[model samples]
Target: MRMNPTFIVMMKCSEEAGVQNPVFQRLYICLGALKKGWKEGCRRILGLDGCFIKGFHTGQLLTAIGVDPNNQMYLVAYALVESECKDTWC
Candidate 1:
């Protein structure tokens, strides 16, 4: 955040029934550089997708992508959430 004032980072946590403290539920990140680059050089069209994450951390990985003027893929943003559901997407 210090490096990029426009950067955005968010974290969500929830308390379990018997947990003593809040547990991490989700995280979202969008770098300032990436966002600026997308807005200035990428096409208006955007594509969103998600996939399940395996191993130690079990969740979903969501991504937003766009196309550049050169017709190449340009990653806009991404997030890690507990699940791929309507609520999570929002």
Candidate 2:
């Protein structure tokens, strides 16, 4: 589906809201992007910060992995940690 001005890429509900399910539409869009270009030269050292939740629990330190332009091992992966550790992260 062509992206309209009001098309929501993602949503929390399964039921249709404004237009044909925004979530599905967004999924399709993402899939299209993936198909358009394969992951290459995207790997790089990934640095991530902690992420918190909305519950009765303390915030969590997490990491995110991604590639760089040179396809080098960027942020490898995200792991829950007690605190921020730069040396341990990279």
Candidate 3:
């Protein structure tokens, strides 16, 4: 299978930015899809929430956002928060 240049570039960029592996490839795809879909239509959101993983203590942090309309999933955004503020997740 052919490798994606964006992943390669993102991995290198992440390393340079001091971010660890298992990086933001999925979120990147979601963002790219959203960008493409914007020309088609705008996505509406009903409710959004974030979930935690990797136990209470870990190397990196994660938060998930979902963009939905009429119970249909459209887009998602994930953030790696490095702060203690659980409410202020991206």
Arrange candidates, best lDDT first: 1, 2, 3
Q: What does the lDDT read for residue 32 in candidate 2?
A: 33
lDDT of 3 at 16: 42
TM-score of each: 0.86, 0.29, 0.36
lDDT of 3 by residue, 3-79 (tens): 43322111111244555563332221235554445335545433344454466543233433344444455544344
lDDT tens per residue, model 2, 18-65 = 767443111111233422232444543444555754455433446454
lDDT of 3 at 6: 23
The list of candidate 3 runs beyond 4 A from truth reads 1-30, 56-70, 83-90
Per-residue lDDT tens digits for candidate 1, residues 16-89, read 89989998899999988999999998889899988999999899999999899999989989999999878775
Pick out the ten consecutive residues of candidate 1 with the lowest summed lDDT.
Answer: 81-90
TM-score of 2: 0.29
Each prediction's number of clashing residue pairs: 0, 13, 0
List the pairs of residues colliding in candidate 3.
none
What is the descending TM-score order? 1, 3, 2
Please name the candidate that would achieve the greatest TM-score relative to the true structure. 1
